[model samples]
Target: MVSGSNGDGVRVPSASFSRLSATNVLFGWTWPQLAVGGVGLVLLVIGGAAGFNLPVMLVGVLVMAYGLVRFQGLSLLAWTYVWFTWRSRLREGSNVWSSSPLETGRTVGVLGVWSQVEDRAQVVEGESVDVVGTPWRDACYLYDPDKRQATAVLTLKVEEWSLSTNARKRDRAMALNNLTMTLASTPGVVELKETSLLMPTSAPVPPDLDDPDMPSWARGDLAELWAMPEIATPLANVSWVSVSVNVDRLSTRSRNMDRLTERNRVGVLLGDIVQNVVAPALVECGGQHGSIRWCSVDELRDMIRCVSDPAHASSQRKVRRGEPTLSYCEESADGEYVTLESCVARSWWVTQWPDRPVPAGWTRDILQGDRMIALTHIWRPLSMAESEKDLANKQSSMLQRSRLADQKRLSRDERRERREQAQREAEQDANWPDTDHQGYITLFAPDKSRLDDLERGLRMETGKYHLTLNGLTGQQRKALATVLPLGV
Candidate 1:
């Protein structure tokens, strides 16, 4: 990083970061500026040596300087990861001030077809581009004609990531269905008067890989690779805005295949074109060709949090005369993703209804455990085994409560009165003090080295008995705490 006293006073700094932490790092440099700067510097230096043109080398020195400037401060880099909250399908865009903001007079229109492009103007710089609803991450192509240097920021506001084959098929089928109806209703456009479906009669028999007469019993070896997902070559040209990628064959050999489900196979494509392509090309186009999109600092912060923990949301809010509030909560898993679902009402969500919004000052259910008390929090899907276990525990708890109810034969109103009366008595009892004192158990060790082994043995024993425990102090009491568990 360099700070020239004669140049603009923008701060320049540098530091190292892990490789994965460095991808979203946004910075800009024009190839022309760098190339010109390089040539000028070399010519000026050589000219100085050869005695021809000192100014050429000086100009080259100025142009040759380029850098990857960190967009937002790296300290807050943790929240910028937004694969959550925002789905992978939604478009994302952001407004980045270049060395200068775009003046108001400029007007720009963007088109998708590559034939219309006139010059090499990148969109992420100068003015903003795309519709207001277009997300930051979905910046396919942006256009800003104003020239004075500015930044074309890449915003990542991911939308949906449900890219499974079933999802795609359903999406395509829905589109097809809508098209069918639209064509039938309207007369002007091409018509889908009729429709039919077809299915493959049989799986393609793969070529035998070994000796022709190898027994069918041993033929399993030949079918191994043949059973892999087949790749289909691209059929038509897709003219996407800003980016033009020729789609190749779609292959299923990329990811997990063992746990494959119907209506889908794992993702197959020519990289993340539908989502990651497009708008980025606008930024790359530069000049009047590019467009810009930006969210407020506060919205960007919330967006970052949402993206980082898609499953959990960290919200920012302000009330009329109050300090801004930051609240957090986890999103419910999609029903289709409930792998270990149990047929019981013991689900955390089932027990604690979600239809109602959470009240203020009540974050226990949101951040902590959703159980009766939340001391520790874990965000993970409940597998069927765990769901089953929860069901059993809930039934047992219900049985205990049922027994208590049965023991007191009362109507609904009477039961309520009785429960209230019992609660009051329990409260009264809690207020009363008890005088029973606990005695300490002490084990005297002949050698200090032996105490470590004794403590370890006692700790293991306590765990076996499901005994409550805490750290022990005083050598005598500590020794006793460990030894007593062994006996119990």
Candidate 2:
């Protein structure tokens, strides 16, 4: 493997040792483009046969070029329209109350204390329900009140280890390979809806640091730490991996089944997956499964209240404000998104993917930094046929762009970029067998100044992989919601 120096002068393994060739053509013109070109050709021939009318021939030529250049855009538009129409028709035909159960469903309320919820069913009065009985069980479930579909969510902590060295690199690779295999074996059994790794800023002292029994010297040090700027303040590296799965497929129950029965069934399935699949996988990766529990109603309510009103969260003097009194949020001027709790966060979408093949655990650096960060990955499964079609379309687009670059006699940098993109696409077609993946990273800090520092750290860390992150802007709240284990 080739090694390169990072901004800190630390030697890190390069993404790939050898460059892949991008001269091969994997796909040609798509069917839609061909059909449009055929029509344009016919029009051009007719105009020529009718004494070569300049306007008609010129229109035909323009139409042909448009069909060729904007083929992907037009095709995507058509596909989107067809998909919406089909979904609308299905909703109309079904007796279901809403188009999507996730959007309209009421949250599955959790009762009892955090310590009381366990992996096993808890017998209470006349009903038996599995409780999410652990402090680490930061998962929440959303229940469709109408359809009775239950979606269970659990956010497990992610552990970060060094990957720059050879031994650590090998370990990272094995862990990732094992994870991929485990996920693939599950088939349609469970869905890894979202995986988030967050590193929020650490508090200077424990919540109980104000005890009178504390020594004066220790108290002085604690106070100094607290007074330090967030950038200088040590960060608590916490990584959370949230997984969401639908519970309807776990059993052969009818759609009219009782809500309690459905909830119990889902709870059992989620617990089993955690104990059997998820926990084992983490153990194999040299990490322990921290907590696995369904999210409580109180926690969900608190989150909703905080997101809705930042003032309630930011207020120091707590007056009784009905339910969800302990709010934590800071809203932007427009009030679309909020700085949640003590963390000033901004979500980022991966705009530019790495052109080269990086080590499997390259994300370790991104997750482990002096500043708090959360990285979320959402994978949408696609059938084999769909994957093939999508790959073909991408290959064709890359080829078109490369040809265009050549025709335009673009600069060496531009040409190199096109070639690298094509090479990366080809590599993905050959190697990646998973579903379509979308990645988001959220950086958090105690305040705006710390947030800027965290952002800078993120940029420097991601620069090692040649990746670019663009802020989600107005969609920060939505992005944050995805990162949290809300099952929304």
Best by lDDT: 2
CA lDDT scores, all candidates in order: 0.26, 0.50
Which regions in candidate 1 have their CA more than 4 angstroms from the true location?
1-37, 49-54, 66-488
Pick out the ten consecutive residues of candidate 2 with the lowest summed lDDT. 112-121
- TM-score list, all predictions: 0.15, 0.56
Scored by TM-score, the top model is 2
Candidate 1 residue lDDT tens string, 1-488: 11112124422221111111121211122344335445656766786787766576566454444222233222212213333222321232111101112412221212111111212222321124422223343232222233211112222222122332333323333332233232222211111111000101123455666767888766885566555532111111111111111112223445554564311221112123223432333232221233333323233233222222222221223121111111211111221100101100001111111122222112212211111111111111222343344334433544455677787666653454345334434433443211111212121122334434444554454344232332221121112111211110
Off by over 4 Å in 2: 1-140, 144-150, 157-160, 163-172, 185-190, 193-234, 246-260, 289-322, 325-344, 368-370, 381-432, 445-457
Q: What does the lDDT read for residue 295 in candidate 1?
A: 26
